[model samples]
Target: MQEWFVDVAEHIADGDPIYLACEECGQVALPPRTVCPDCAGRSLEQRPLSETATVTAETTIFSSTPRYAEETPYTIVIATFEEGVRLTGQLRGAETVERGEEVRLGVESDGDHWLITFTPSD
Candidate 1:
């Protein structure tokens, strides 16, 4: 699982974030996985994901894990893309995000790794 996430970060750093979709069931998995969670399909293929998504849910984090403890009071959001896939990323470039707000996906280097981020759009 950690390697899967690392691949996602690397892809984002390359400016081409991608997700894995099960060839048999069409279930998309962010961070790419060998098996589809929805159907247990083994043949997964890389799929292009949109750079824009809509905020579907959000919350202010007053506390966070050790990795993000220094960035408390930050916002995390669940954004849904055109691929019908939803991903969770830290919200940026806005103090507040409302449900259904449009957001553009982005990546940021966090020392040794990259982070998934989203900024308000229009």
Candidate 2:
């Protein structure tokens, strides 16, 4: 993985979810980059991601690799945070959600691996 990717994973694993916002263009980047993707600026700062998000898109998976076979019929969601950055994660502990539904951001860990999760807030 890219070093930046590891840095982001570590930050979230440490219980502080963060995103890099570009000072130049007001663009937020999750899984941060050293330079601003929108404006090619180098002034990016780490900011905490809001704990809540609104579902913007969703998909259901009926089949999967062995690791996730038991979790089939699961849903995935793309949620938009207050800062306007969108994050995609597995939606858990709730029925499939619609666009505009509220959800709580979370990180699910299986010791050696981690997955992002969004649970319905309502």
Candidate 3:
């Protein structure tokens, strides 16, 4: 994982999710960076992320390495927050979801690792 992702993980672990925002262009980045990818601006701020997001895309995984083989048929989702930040996370506690569905963003522990987690909000 990238070092910037660790910062996001830390915030998620603390129950305070955050994202990067370009102070110059107002572009939000989930996997954050020191410089804005959109405008190449150097001033970035860590901003709190919204609790809810809309599902933009989804996929079902049926095959994986041994570590996650048993968790086959799990759903992964790409969601976009109102701030225009997009993130990919595992959809938990829901068997199926649709594009445009609303989800609540969160973090969950999977064994010794922390993962981005999402659940149906509507």
Say which candidate scores most in TM-score.
3
RMSD per model, one decimal: 1.9, 1.8, 1.5
> TM-score per candidate, in order?
0.87, 0.88, 0.91
Q: What is candidate 2's lDDT per residue for 1-122, written digit by digit as tens?
A: 35665566566667777888999999888767888989999999999878889999999999998989988989999999998788889998886898999998877667666677899987
lDDT of each: 0.85, 0.84, 0.85
Error of 1 at 86 (Å): 1.7
Q: What lDDT would candidate 1 get against the real structure?
A: 0.85
| Residue pairs with clashing backbones, model 3 | none
Q: Candidate 2 at 65: error in angstroms?
A: 1.1
> 4-98, model 3: which lDDT tens digit per residue?
66668778778788888999999887688767999999999988888889999999998877877888878999999998989899999899799
Of 1 and 3, the candidate ranking higher by TM-score: 3
User: Least lDDT summed over 10 consecutive residues: which range in candidate 2?
Assistant: 1-10
